[model samples]
Target: MSELNTGDSIEELKVTPDKYVPHRYAGATGDFNPIHIDPEFAKMVGLPGSILHGLYVMGLVAKTSAGAAGGDPRALKSLSVQFRGMSFPEQEITITGEVTGVEGDQVTVDVVAAQGDSQVIRNATAVLEIPPG
Candidate 1:
């Protein structure tokens, strides 16, 4: 959004998922899956604990993309992210992106959201239209 060019890095976002994130998310989205809200159930099912919802993490990545695209949701053309690993609550996930291509009014950006050394979102890409100055 600010004189964007290929290889330019977007402002990174640091996200620390709260301990109550899963509970709040469940209350808000009506997705009360035990794997996301019931730690005991999750452990019984072989998960380390109640994991954050995948869509929640994806939405955060999208929000980061929107911020990079001039903070206007309309500038976004498309967004995609592959869920490569689980993201646990109370862990910090860093959202980072770099401009990959620019042609005409379209700009492509490669993005990743990682927790520690693990990638929670991979193959993340966003296409946006640069608003006329």
Candidate 2:
């Protein structure tokens, strides 16, 4: 793995959630909100269609940050995100991160996730604990 330094950009990650992803996520998270699993209900509620859970999009941010730390899940220390907009299924979500600070083995990253022209997550941050060589 390349050494992480301040101002360095992490590799971008992209994922396309299929239409059924919301349904499966709803079952796993027990968040069966109609807006997430029922397209008709979502439309009635003003959403374009069934939307992906906000937490799910946050998970993608965490995944991207962890990947920057050599793909080690344990390296992730903390994550915070602001849900900026709704994200729908079958659309590609792009996750990007940049190293904002590096102190010893701890690295802080600023992250963002977007779909098409809309940003699904913003003002996101992740701290990772990478071991010293």
Candidate 3:
């Protein structure tokens, strides 16, 4: 493994959920929220359309963080995020992250999810344990 220093930039991960992403996630997670699976219902509720699950987006952030830390998912110790906006299917979501701190084996990162110009996940943070090589 390469040396990791504070202020190191993490590689960005981008995701473009297909139209059936919500349905697939709903089936996998048992979160059948209409806002995430029903376009008409979402529109009726004043949304542009069916929105992606917040947890799904968070999962993307988590995976991205793990990848940044040498692709070991177990290295991720903690993750927190604030869902600030809705994400619709077929929209490109980019996960941006930076190493904010490094203490011993712990690496703290500031992460966010962006949909075009919109910041969908705000105040996102992830802590990972990078194994020494």
Alpha-carbon RMSD to native, per candidate: 1.0, 0.9, 0.9
- For candidate 1, write residues 63-124 as lDDT tens digits: 88888876898988899889999989999989999999999888898999999999989899
Instruction: State the lDDT of candidate 2 residue by residue for 1-133, as single tens digits.
Output: 7789999999999999999999899899899999999999999988888999999999889989999978898999999999989998998999999999999999999999999999889889899999977
Q: What is the lDDT of residue 103 in candidate 2?
A: 95
Candidate 3 segments exceeding 4 Å error: none
List model 3 lDDT by residue over 56-133, tens digit each. 999999998998877897899999999998888998999989888999999999998999899999799999998788
Candidate 1 pairs with clashing backbones: none
Compared with the true structure, all predictions reach lDDT values of: 0.89, 0.92, 0.91
Candidate 2 TM-score, C-alpha based? 0.96
Candidate No. with top lDDT? 2
Residue 61's lDDT within candidate 2 is 93
